[model samples]
Target: MNEQSLNLDSQKVDETFFTVKLPEQVGLSDQLWHLSKLYTLGIALSYTYVHTPFKCPRSYNVGYFETVIEKSKSILNKFTSINSSSTDKLIEFIGLDKHELNISDQQFELCNIVEINIDEILKDDKINSTSDLKKCIEYFGLYSKEKIYSFVTKGIYKFESKIEQIVRSANLDDSTIKKLKLPEKYWKAKEKFSGKFSIDNSKVKITLHIRKGDRTCINLNGKLVSVFASSIKVIDSTDYRDELKQSLMDTTKAYNLIQEIFNKYGEEYFSVQVLSDGYQRTFFTIIWAMVRGKIKLNLNDLKQLHKTKKALSKEFNDFLRFSNISLVVGESKQNLFQSIHAIVCADILIITSGGFAYWVHNFFRKSNQPSLIINLNSCDNKVVNKISKFL
Candidate 1:
């Protein structure tokens, strides 16, 4: 009648004493001398036969899970339960269906349970559901739910830390951080955003008909639609003015230096190699550079471009270390697993220096010379090549 009588004890007695083990135990302690001999086998058989699925139910009383299911039902119950049907439904409001929301990640967590089974009427003493709970106490060194709950809550508090790292590493503005409701502890905005412009869709026309204020996106007929705010950074006329001035200075300086070096070497060491990222400006600069100099680099022209076909790859990375360049860019576009925007900006700037080292093969092909050149960060660190014509 009591709780213990119903579940384990009764069932266990039925199998251990009344059935398989009992027959083996029947007639053995001497008259049934074999009974003692077989006692070990009987216990093993009893355990296997009676206690097959060693499930440790969380509670002896099913009420605990009953309560859980009730709670789940309360929140999820359809028209069949307490909440009545409504024209304005949550599923409709959220634009989703009941089957779609498995929002709970509970299944991903470790199972924390007590004994395998518990009936409400069967007290903990009767069914001893506390065995698994006792295991939890030993494992966690905390017997009370309140203690375990506090420890777990502390662990979850770390969730706040990760948000700050995301914010800082993203280089987000304070206002953006505030808007995201992120705490500052975890976000790390270590990366910078480098910027560069490129001519997209090279075949796209830029005819004289394309007025400064014209909608370039238009077809020949001009239906006056598909107006996209052109993302191309249109260089102002002033860009050429500055470039021309620099070109004059940089070109003259570099030419004079090259001339001096050439006069000393006299076609023996006098070699030149033109490097470009396939940009028209770089090509133009190279052409103008040759014109400015009375000297002509005969026998070769060195032109190498990456297979990527992009004017500049996303950014430069430590790969330049092998080439002896230290390039740092502010671009955080992770399209590149290695380099960033900082590398590109640095490269472009370095063209002011004597330009990149002449790669040996490139030198041999372009000019009859043996030079080791790598575009490590040559463009960003030096204006020598970029502005040799002006100087």
Candidate 2:
């Protein structure tokens, strides 16, 4: 059958149809963000239904995109398609799955499917900012601010639940289950590849999220030195060193930060879990310098020593030997989500000044759960004091 024969004839169809294509490929987290944006846009536009042609290449990981997409489709069904009687059924009835529609799709000339330039739509004066793709969604004009918020919130919850399920499925052993059940008691690396370490539990649980990769850094004599873009630096004097001190909280500073939290919330109430690209080798390079005593343990140096594989692995492991503080380092997307989920559920949460940190901070804030977001981007003690008031 020809593509034109599938979709309804534009002149006769009662409902308007439009679609927003997802990026060709992206990380699972990024993909979910896009889907949420698309959902928001569809609800705003009064479009018949929003469609996504999300399919991964055979070479890439399969479950990452497909699993989240399935969960999103389920959530969309709740607000949109109720039964086979819905528009999805209409599309199927007309035999349209085989054809992929784009700007030049012949189907657009005869049917309701039409090319929509998001840029043109976003140029409207009503949209105040185009900084975020989600910001532009409000211009669709299909729903009010209240309705859009409700739908997007629902979508986020659905995706979060799916991520939790993925983590649960990956963790089937007793050791992993024990850690998840009482994370505070078993503050060790969750992934089997990481060497085991354990310590006593505390009264409070704080999840730390560190985002690395693509951030500008200097390779000094084979050692990695993280340089924050916002901080002022000088080639001579202690400016660069001092700036580094403020930008990242090293092991001692991290310990000190936790102690401060302990002082406010009570020593027995606080424990820590780290949600990051734990085993990512490149991110851990700075830890090499930390272990060698070339640099202090700071935010950029954060990551479970056991999860990483570096030439100085033994030295890093030895450094962890005497440490009283222990944390559960996230291994996968599901594991990371579980930590984030716990952070959202916990009475107290702490985050740094990284992009992912801000992302998590925003999540809790929108959920109406006020959290302690320490801007590690700057070392000013006032920032700590500001966080204390939140606690």
| Top-lDDT structure, candidate number | 2
- Whole-model Cα lDDT of every candidate shown, in order: 0.23, 0.39
Model 2 stretches astray by more than 4 angstroms: 1-14, 17-20, 24-38, 48-204, 213-253, 279-326, 330-334, 360-370, 378-391
- Tell me the tens digit of each residue's lDDT in model 2 across 1-391: 6657655454334444445444433433343354444434443334334333343221122334554675576566557321121222211211222223232334343332233445454445453322332344434534422121112222233334332333334432222312112222122223331332232223344655544322333333323355332221213333455544443333345546656655665644445554444333233334443555656644432543233334222222322332333444424434544554444444444454444445433433333445555544454566555554433
State candidate 1's TM-score: 0.16
Instruction: Report the CA-based lDDT of candidate 2 relative to the real structure.
Output: 0.39
Residue by residue across 201-235, what tens digits does model 1's lDDT show? 21111100001111121111211111112122222
Weakest ten-residue segment in model 1 by summed lDDT:
205-214
TM-score, one value per model: 0.16, 0.44
The segments of candidate 1 whose C-alpha lies over 4 angstroms from its true place after superposition are: 1-240, 247-253, 277-391
| Cα-based lDDT at residue 10, candidate 1 | 59
